[model samples]
Target: MPSSDAPSIRPRRLRSTPAMRRLVAETRLHPAELVLPLFVREGIDAPRELQAMPGVRQHTVDSLRRISAEAAAAGLGGVMLFGVPAVRDARGSGIDDPDGILNVATRAVQQEVGDALVVQTDLCLDEFTDHGHCGVLAGDGSVDNDATLERYRSAAVAQADAGAAMLGLSGMMDGQVAAVRDALDAAGHADTAILAYAAKYASAFYGPFREAVDSQLTGDRRSYQQDPANRREGLREAELDLAEGADVLMVKPAMSYLDVLADVAATSPVPVWAYQVSGEAAMIEAASANGWIDREAAIHESLISIRRAGADAILSYFALEVAERLR
Candidate 1:
């Protein structure tokens, strides 16, 4: 039955069945590779759902603990926490305060979860600053890099003191990893890890995130965040972070900057993570709501895309749901 013109090799046999495909799949997604990014607002007695992000919410401290436990039970790797303070000021004084919402939340989560999973804190002042900038401003109204480092140093110690296992240095400040690393080491927190947002870009996909944090910013962060046009700059930033002692390097807006993520991951000596930002999730949710796509399939595909692009871990709004499904 052999034909002279027929091809001898075919690839379809491997993909002909679900079990066959699963057996030979090159990339696999596991619940332990996902990290849930959670928000906690100080004044809310109840969790407040984010409109732009339908399924996500700004949770109360009590609610945060509940969901965090659920995440751990679901076998998710970790949870990254961001705080929305009841009141904000120019310097974001709340960031370093022992009784501040973020610090308090860190303590609560550590007590609740213990070592079940990593408890990470977002080490940025945007949620605590009235101006909604990642760092404090100079007299000229621009973010002051060195001055912000001073703030981050104290904040790093405070987060460490509160029992945060990792501090996500997401401010995009120069030498931020080194500064925070030094502070953490000096404060008897040498064991604490740092997750550096090494290649964060100024992108339109941050809109939903601004709403999530109740940002009061009037202008853009282009001056600090990497320009979207510069592909090489992303790799450069990753190198800088690695040199500065970052324990983990992250590329933000995972889908959009997958090339950058791959570049960083290819060379990084440590674990590389990626964030599936709010806008990315909102787009998928909106499309699914309109019945334009299969929601579950899309979520699975999107996450697999990120993992295939070389992220060791992913921070996603869908982490818990996806993790549950994987289980």
Candidate 2:
């Protein structure tokens, strides 16, 4: 037994210095472990800043190419692209259109930094659908999962043809991973990969994203997205995606779902990633803007927390800025 003057095991010795703390850190965030999510719009002549998400913007095709190149040169892992089209229809036809905004942006970025960065595109229809749903709506106003899978198959081919290194299936449609994977393979894009948004939840945290993507959704996405209360379901979703040929698995709204992220990461044979969703990022920025928290430190802490939760990669709006700091 130790006396009152000395502790049995004093952990403070290692915490005495920053260098010692760094040396013993179990989770280290690196530039390569960050992926930036960007938005590109069709008719915007110049990049327009998103009001809800302070520093993020809706980029033009030209701006996307330039920024993507910059991100590549910054030595970040990759960039995920979401397109805002000039028009939307019931079927979200733009998603599978070869000349659609997303495909066009993907091609442009591939040309600008093809081998330098892993170019990925959002494999979802919400931004392209006038109905503001992730899938095609049936006569009764329900999102048709099977019908949406067909559209995803078409979108997969279009994205792969546009030089996307990987397709991020964020639509939360069931069997999306298998459908997109088979679609890519059959379309002669066998080398292309799929990043399944396996544990996406219908969280209120997507508020800023709705604004960022110009989402037309008037109703909630509770029908397709997972319930936030279910931890077991997250693991089940991850397992399904794994069996369906997903190259990577992702959990959205990372901060609120660290437990799900950790559980998924624990069993995933492939890389497990998490999105520091728009709301999460916006909250930090908003608080920092009010001088409530140290901006840099908060961002670093949030990222490290996500990393400590077992994410192999973090999809963040601040990826570029944070990666620059990490470098």
TM-score of each: 0.99, 0.98
Per-residue error for 208 in candidate 1, Å, reads 0.9
Model 1 residue runs over 4 Å out of place are none
Error of 1 at 296 (Å): 0.5
Per-residue lDDT over 1-327 for candidate 1, one digit per residue giving the tens place of the 0 to 100 score: 888989879999899999999999999999999999999888888999999998999989899999999999999999999998888999999999999999999999999995899999999998899999999999999999999999999999999999999999999999999999999999899999999999999989989988788888989899999999988999999999999999999999899999999999998999999999998999999999999999999999999999999999999999999999998
Q: lDDT per prediction?
A: 0.94, 0.93
Candidate 1 clashes between residue pairs 3 or more apart in a chain or in different chains: none
lDDT of 2 by residue, 65-101 (tens): 8989889878999999999999999999999899999
True-structure lDDT of candidate 1: 0.94
List RMSD in Å for every model shown. Answer: 0.8, 1.5
- The alpha-carbon deviation from the true structure for residue 5 of candidate 2, after best TM-score superposition, in angstroms, is 5.3
Q: After TM-score superposition, what is the CA distance of residue 72 in candidate 1 from its true location, in Å?
A: 0.5
